[model samples]
Target: MCSHYDPVLNAQKLKQHFGVDDLPPGLKPSLWPTYVGPFLRKHEHADVGDEAVPFKELMVGSFGLIPHWAKDTKIARQTYNARSETVHEKPAFRDSWRLNRHCIIPAEAIFEPDWRSGKGVATRIVRTDGKPMGIAGIWTGWKNPANGEILRSFSMLTVNADDHSFMRNFHKPDDEKRMVVILHEDEYDGWLNSTAEDARHYLRQYPADGMRVAVHD
Candidate 1:
């Protein structure tokens, strides 16, 4: 599961690569659980049949999902990544999953720990083509009752990666290996608009050959 990553911070790259027209303020260069970052979701006006409005809209949200019933935002630390197989059953993620609140996390790279060397070594993973990765996710809004402040948050969707030649190398030897779902460029719109049933088709693992990993110093 991804807990640390580099978000696409360049305005030009956000626009050219993700088709996001504007960059919202307060996005960080690096993100961890509870950190605010950029994500893409279907524009609200898209269903209105307006051809002039873009299909996707850029949003800034917490990296970890905060359920509506939560008392505070601290729960975000434990809800950063939702397992694809159990997302529908998990209380924190089920509502968003059922509602088809799909989102795309725009990331420059994801950081994981490599344990092959007998010690945890930080590694940076990115696409071989040097393009941004559009990771699959689900989003929702949580309101703080005390102040009535609305906070938007999301969680990355992960799949088992024990059989993946590349992804299986990360994490601990005894732990179940996992990897985030990286969607292909062409599937962005399909994923954003897909129904709960169709969203499963986009949760598969990304091909290992298309990715490059290096030791992070």
Candidate 2:
């Protein structure tokens, strides 16, 4: 599961690659569980009126998902990554998954642990082409009972990568390999508008050939 990543912070890249204008403020340089970051969702008015209205809108939110039933924001620590196989049944993720609150998490790179060199080593993975990654995810809102404030959050969806040529190299050898689902540029709109059942089609692993990895010193 992806627990750490660098959120895309370049304004021009965000605008040109994701078609998102007006960057949200307070996005952290890097994201971990509970960290705030930007996510792209289908614009509420996408199909309502003017054709000039962008198809997507950018919003800032916690990197981890916070369900409506969550008692507090601390749940974010454990809800950062939703397993694709059981997201529909997991309490922390089911609501957003069922409601089709699909979103795209734009990331500059994702970090994973490589244990091949006798110990765990942090490794960074990014697209070989140097473009930002549009990771598939789900978003939701939670109302704080104590303060009556609405907290928005999201979680990246992950799939089994046991057979992936590149991704299978990370993590402990004994553990099941996994990788986040990254959408192609052309599939963004289709994924955001897809129904719950149809969203499953976009949950597959990204091709290993499209990514490049570097070990951190």
Candidate 3:
């Protein structure tokens, strides 16, 4: 149920952590589709020495699956997220989960909340440590015939809520799901190279304790 997040890491953070600098131009195009402008500016940066991929854009802001055979884009609106447990078995995510596992989803923090009014009102949630969090993700490339251009899009993974107390009260009734798949630095390589089984093995470590959380402003 991660509906909102903030990118606390600008160009510097990306560079410092992953060693990839030189951001996409403006990076606006990668923001959620149908949303207004962008949450941040785009610049290319990386640690002083590490090499990273540079693209027309960097932030894959929106979350969801854009089915390879989709006739229209609306399907993604309802599929911005896929559960980590079944991702490898689900039709939409199965392929990507096994072969396209990727990372680098930078966000200051994501928001989740409970709405007693029977309406979804997101209460911005962030980590108390105030550092940007990276949500584990997968991306796909698409082509628009009208412009003969290629576009890359991505989706975030979610897990059932176990210890995130702030999210327990507002948990989605069906699953009481609140936790997201946060890849650890040690597991990045495994995730990036995992087969279906490997992907599941590494993602299971995300729910371990020690991460911080609080209501976002």
> Best candidate per lDDT, number?
1
What tens digits encode model 3's per-residue C-alpha lDDT throughout 10-84? 678766554445554454322343231112211234223435533213444335566565554565666556788
The deviation in Å at residue 3 for candidate 1 is 0.5
Write candidate 1's Cα lDDT for 112-196 as tens digits. Answer: 8889998878789999888999999999999999999899999999999999999999998888999999999999999999999
What TM-score does structure 1 among the candidates reach? 0.97
**All models: lDDT?**
0.93, 0.92, 0.55
Order of candidates by lDDT, top first? 1, 2, 3
Give the range where candidate 2 is weakest over 10 consecutive residues by summed lDDT.
Answer: 208-217
Clash counts for the predictions, in order? 0, 0, 14
Pairs of colliding residues, candidate 1: none
How far residue 176's Cα lies from its native spot in candidate 3, in Å, is: 2.7
Structural similarity to truth (TM-score) of each candidate: 0.97, 0.96, 0.73
Please name the candidate that would achieve the greatest TM-score relative to the true structure. Answer: 1
